[model samples]
Target: MSLIQACVTAATTLLAVLIGGWLTVRTQDRLWRRDQERQWRDIRLNAYTDFIGAVREYVAFILNPAARITVVPRPRDPGDLMPFFDDVGSRYRERLESTKTALRLVAGRPEVVSVSAELVRQARLLAAARADSGVEALQADRFDALWEAERRFIETARADLGLPSAFVS
Candidate 1:
């Protein structure tokens, strides 16, 4: 073949190879994105469940200071439950922080962020109820208010977490 004909053949081969490489890379990227989405769903499920556990613990803490709380090797009940109370409080705090980290890694969807924040608010309100101590009826009313807030905040969390309403009870 002539020199010009040889160069034209080589150019055609290069174009075909480039197109094939592009197609392979595109297919690989699509599969990888699907796998990452599945992993995200799993992380969300774990984080949501942890949030539920922490909220319920706080509600119990607020409803009755004298109620028993248990840990390995011992169970504790006291008017002040100070040491045990502090431990439980810390546990909830840590769970909340980890959930936040997971959300950030997932790009922090607004639904998840709002619901999680509401649950945290409920926990804090219940903690405040435990601190309310006085003979007055108005002081007693704080417990009632705290209980209402518990239901309100947790409902939002449940919906965002994709949990059924039946699970709320």
Candidate 2:
């Protein structure tokens, strides 16, 4: 081959190597990003589920007839429940707080944080309602509002995590 032809062949080979390397890197970067997104979505799902579960447990304790009685060791007698109140309240409160902290660590969007705060607020309202009236009052008046807040939180978290919503037609 001519010297000029040999140089041209080498230049073409170098160019092909560079282009192939760039494409490979670009494809790998895209795959990495997709994997990261999926991992993040899973974390958000776990956190959100935990937070809701804690909230439900709290509400259940409030609505439980036994919660109204005051006594230590949690009276087995259905009539004596006052002592169980403080323990149940604090235990569920800790669970809710722990879940919220986990969510704060994993949440990528500000709206999810905001909605989580709303969920906490609504759950507190249910607790307060139970205190003011009775379990019957919570079922009557406060349950709907708490349900709505929880629904909003779930929807917002799903959107933030890029999960598809059944509500979207």
Candidate 3:
């Protein structure tokens, strides 16, 4: 072939290769994004379930701290706190799995890590609050601090996910 024709053929092949590469990348990228969104939703759901359940447990425990600690020393009884434990435990496990999946999908987004850490912190605080119950905890700052932390977490979650305050768990 002539020199000009050879150059034209080479350019065409190069263009075709580039276009094919771009198409493949686009398709993969789209699929990845879709999957990332799915994972985000799943993690959020799990986080909500466990986190909200924990919050409800705290509220109930607070309503009658005397009954929970004094009247019924076995606060973990099914009628009082056992069920909450089960719910929180199951939900937390689910949340953990979903979080790992999301991290894999998003490749370690810092916000997610921070949120997860806060979730742990909140759980620990609640557990601590439960430990100091009845009259001993009536004016304890631990419970208040825990409540404040939870409120902050809810607000942060809302701001990040654009969910309403009611969506907080």
Candidate 4:
């Protein structure tokens, strides 16, 4: 080939290589970002599930009459019940706090974090009320409020993770 043709061929090849490299890098970057997003969603979902589970367990323990008796046998004096409440409440609170912290760290939206916080707050309130009085102290209003908080948290978390709502219109 002539000198000009050789230089033209070299330039064309160089251009093709540059374009190919750029495209490859762009595609790889996109894939990496997609993978990272999927991983984050998984983490957030796990955190949300864990937090919800902790709250449910805590509520169940507090509400179940058998659970209370199993934790600490009833004493002749009603005042002696404080120790039982303290023990069960503290253990459940620790689990809830740990899961809440994890949810906050991985939550994609502020709403999810706020709702989770509200749920935790409601759980704490219910625990306190039950501890101070007795299981009978768990009023319907407080129970409803706790359920509402949980519903909001679940909704927010579902939205954050791109999942459909549990309820239908």
Note the Cα lDDT for every prediction shown: 0.56, 0.77, 0.55, 0.80
Q: lDDT per residue, candidate 3, 88-118, as tens digits? A: 3445435544554554343323564465455
TM-scores for the candidates: 0.54, 0.83, 0.46, 0.84
Q: Who wins the lDDT comparison? A: 4
The window of 10 residues in a row where model 1 has the poorest summed lDDT is 74-83
Whole-model alpha-carbon lDDT for candidate 1: 0.56
Clash counts per candidate, in order, are 0, 7, 1, 0
Please give, for residues 136-163, the per-residue lDDT of candidate 2 as tens digits. 6656456777788888888888888777
The per-residue C-alpha lDDT of model 4 at residue 66 equals 48
Better of 1 and 4 by lDDT: 4
Q: Candidate 1 has what TM-score?
A: 0.54
Query: What is candidate 2's TM-score against the reference?
Result: 0.83
Weakest lDDT window of 10 consecutive positions for candidate 3: 77-86
lDDT of 1 by residue, 1-93 (tens): 999999999999999999999999999999999887768667766666665665666555545545333322213332322222466466655
lDDT of 4 at 101: 90
